[model samples]
Target chain A: MSQTHVVPTRVYYTIFAILMFCTYLTVQVAFLDLGALNTVAALAIAVFKAVLVVLFFMHVKYSTRLTWVVVIGGAFWLGILLALTMTDYLSRAWGTFG
Target chain B: MLPDAVEHHHPALAHQFDSLAQQREAAALGMWVFLVTEVLFFGGLFATYAVYRWWYPDAFAAASHELDILLGGTNTAVLITSSLTMALAVHSAQLGRRRLLLLFLIATMALGCVFLGIKGVEYYHKFVEHHVPGPGFEFEAAYARQAQIFFSLYFIMTGLHAVHMIIGIGIMLAMFWMSWRGRITADYYNPIEVSGLYWHFVDIVWIFLFPLLYLIGRHA
Candidate 1:
C-alpha cells in the first residue's frame, strides 16, 4: 500500500495566521507615502501571500515533483505572457519608427 | 470465469488505474492542468489592466482612490479566511472526520457568501455613485474617459471573480451533502482535495486583485 502523508492540523493554523497578518500589513503599508515603492511594496506583499497560500494551503510544498513542475510551469508561462506583452506596449513610447 | 475476472476491486479505484494512488495522481494532474488554463484566462485580464494603468497612470491612480479600500481590504481578509477553512476541510476529509469536514465546508461557503455580500454592497455604492462605467457614469471631467476604462476593467475582472465564487459556493454545497452521506472517506477524498485546490486558486486571484485595484494610488 502506498503511504499518504497527512499534514498536521497545527500547520494549517499557522499558515492561516501568517496570511491574515500579511493581509493586515499590506493594507497598512498602502497608507504610507513611498512613491513608486508603493506599487512595488503592494505587489511584493501580494506575491509573498500568494506563495504562502500555494505552498502551504494548496499542499504544493508536500506534493510530488510532478506537481511542482505544473505549478512552476504555470507561473513561468504567466510571466512570459505579461513580460512579452509589456515589452511591446512600453516600448511603443520610445518612437522607433519615423 | 477467468481468474483475472475475480480480482478484488476498490470502490473508488477505476479499473484502468493500477492502484488508487495512481488514480488520485491522475486526477490531481488533470485539475492542475485546468488550473493552469484558468491562470492564463485571468492573466490576460491582468495584462489588460497593466496596459491601461501604464497608459493613464494619473487617471488610474486617481480612479483607484475613489474605490473604498476598507471594503476591499475586508473582502480580502474574508476570502483568505475562507481559503483557510477550505484547506481545513481537505484536512478533515483526509482524516475521515465527517463532522469536521462538514463544519469546515460550511464555514468556507458561508465566508464566500459573506465576501459576495460585501461585494454587493460595494457594487450598490458604485451604482449610486454612477461608477458603473457607461453613459451615466460620472467622474471628474478631466479623467472621466480614462476613469471609465478603469471602471470597465474593474467590473469585468471582479464580476468574473464573483461568478467563480458563486460556482465555488455551489460546489461546496454539493460536497457538504456528499460528506453528510459518508461518500468521502480517508481512502477516497479526491473531490475535497481537488476542490480545495480550486478554492485556493480563486483566493489567489483575489489576493492579487485587491492590491492591484485598491492600492494603486492610495499613497498619492
Candidate 2:
C-alpha cells in the first residue's frame, strides 16, 4: 500500500504565483542597462525560473531521487551536447582570419 | 475472480501488474523515455542555431533585436502560466476534484491559445517586414545572408513548437471531452497526468527557446 505524498494545495498555488512573477522578471531584465552583462543576467534569471518550475510545478522536489535523476540526467546530457559542439563551432576562427 | 467489482481495475490491464498504479507508473516512464528522444530531436535544431549565431554574430543579433520583446515576454508569461494551470490540473485530478480539474484544463488551453495567437502576430509582422527567409525576403545589406539564416532557424524551431502546441490542444480537447463524459475518475486519471507531463515538457522547451531564439544575439 504505497501512498503518494501530494503537496498542500495552497503551497502549489503559491509556487505558481511565484513562477509567474519570475517569468515577468525575466522580461524586465531586458530593459536594464547591463551592457555585456545583460545576457548573463537574463540567462541567470531564466535559470532561476526554470529551477522553480522543476522543483514546484513538476513536484520533482517531493518525488523519489530517481525521478530527479532522470530529469537532471536529461538536462546534463543536453548540456554536454551543446558544450562539446559549440567548443568546435565557436572557436573555429579564434586565432585565424579575424 | 472478475473483481470486475473492483472500482479501478479494467479488463485491459495485464496480470503481471499488482495494481493500476504500477501500470500507470510504467506508462509514465515510457512517456518520459519518448520525451528523451524528443530532447535529441530539438537538440539537433539548437545545435544548428548555435553554429549559425556564432558564425554570423552581427546578423543574428540584429534579427533577435527585431523581435518584439513585449510579444516574447508576454508569451513567456503565458507559457509559464499555462504550465502552472497544467500542474494545477494534475493536482486536481490527484485530489479527485473533477470540476477543478476541468477548470484548470480549460484554463491551460486558453493560455496556450494566447501563445499561438501572439506567435501568429509575430509571424505576420515578419511577413510584412519581409524578414521571412526565401526569395523576395530581403534584409538590411550589412547582414543580408546571415540574417536569412537566423530567420531560417527562427521559423523552423518555433514552427515545430507551434505544431506541438496544436497537437497538445487537440489532446486537451479529447481529454476534456472524456472527463465530461465521466470516463475519467480519480482512480483512472492517468491520462490527465500523462497530458500534464507533455504540457510541462513543452513549457520546458520554450524556457530554453526564449533564451536561444529571442535573447542570444540581441545586444549585438
Candidate 3:
C-alpha cells in the first residue's frame, strides 16, 4: 500500500489565519473609494484566498498531474464561457448592425 | 507466492482492479470529473450575473448596499474555518487518528451549521426589508427594476450555495457514523478524502461568492 502524505496541523492553522486576514482585508477595502480599483482589489484578494484553499485544503498541490489537468481544465472552460459571452455583451454598445 | 497472492486481495480492492492504488486513483479521478461538472454548473450562474452587472452597474451597486457585509464577512470566516477543519479531518483519517478525525468532522459540521444559521438570518433580513424579487420587492424608485434583477441573482446564487452546504453537512454526518463504527481506517479512507474534496469545493464557491455579491457594490 502506498503511504498517503499527512499534512501537518500547523499548516492548516497557518492557512486559516491567512484566509481570515484576507477576508478582513477584502471587507475593509470595499468600504474605501478606489474608483474602478475597488472591484479589482476585491477580486484579486478573492483569487488569492481561493488559491490557498485549493492548494492546501483540497490538496491539489500534492495531487497527481492528471488531477492538476482536471483542475486547470475546469477553470479554463469557465474562462471561455465568460470571455465569449462578455464579448457579445460589451460589443452591443459599439453600434447596431446595419 | 501464495501469501503474496493473498496480500493482493484486499477486500476494498475490486476484482477488476489489479491493486489498491489503482482503485484509489480511479475514485479520485471520478470525483474530480464530477467536480469539474459542478464548476460549470455554477459557472453559468456566474456568467449571467456578470452580464447583468456589466449592463446595469449603477443599479447593481445601489442594490448591493442593502446586503449586510458584517454578516456576510462573518460567514466567510466561518466557512473558511470549516474548510480548515474539514482538511484536518482528512489528514487525521490518513494518519489513522480516529478520534481526531471524528472530532474534526464534527467541528466542520458545527461550523457549517453556523454558516447556514447566519445565512438564514440574512435571508430573514432580506424578507423583512422586502428584498424578495417578486411583486413585494422594494428598492429605491429609480433603481427598482434593475435592483430587482440584482437581488434575483443574489438569491439564486447564494441560495444554491446554501443548498450545497446542507448536502455537505449530511455527507459529513454519514462519514461521522462510518468512522465511529470503524468503517473508515487508514487503509480505506477514500470516502473521507473524497468527501473532503466536496466540502472544500463548496467552500471555494463561497470564497468567490462573498466578494462578488457582498463586497463589489458596497461603495455605491
iRMSD per model? Answer: 1.0, 2.5, 1.2
B1-220: candidate 2 lDDT, tens digit per residue: 6564475556545578877667667666666667777888898898888788767777887888878877987898899889888888888877778899899999999999999999999999999999999997888898888989999999999999999899999999988998888767666677887888788878877887886678754433
lDDT of 1 by residue, B1-220 (tens): 7666446467877789888788888888889999999999999999999999989999999888989988998999899999989998998898889999999999999999999999999999999999999889999999999999999999999999999999999999999998999999998899999999999999999999998898887766
lDDT of 3 by residue, A75-95 (tens): 899899989999999999889
Candidates' lDDT values, in order? 0.92, 0.80, 0.91
What's the TM-score of every candidate structure?
0.96, 0.89, 0.96
Clashing pairs in 3: none
C-alpha root-mean-square deviation, each candidate: 1.7, 2.7, 1.6
lDDT tens digits, residues B1-220, model 3?
6998787688777788877677777777789899999999999999999899999999888888888988998999899989989999998998889999999999999999999999999999999999999999989899999999999999999999999999999999999999999988888888998999999999989999998888766665
Q: Please give the range of 10 consecutive residues that has the lowest summed lDDT in model 2 chain A.
A: A1-10
Docking quality (DockQ) for each candidate: 0.79, 0.46, 0.77
Most accurate candidate by DockQ: 1
Supply the DockQ value of model 1: 0.79
Arrange candidates by DockQ, highest first: which order?
A: 1, 3, 2
Model 3, A54: alpha-carbon shift in Å? 1.0
Model 3 chain A: weakest 10-residue lDDT segment is A1-10
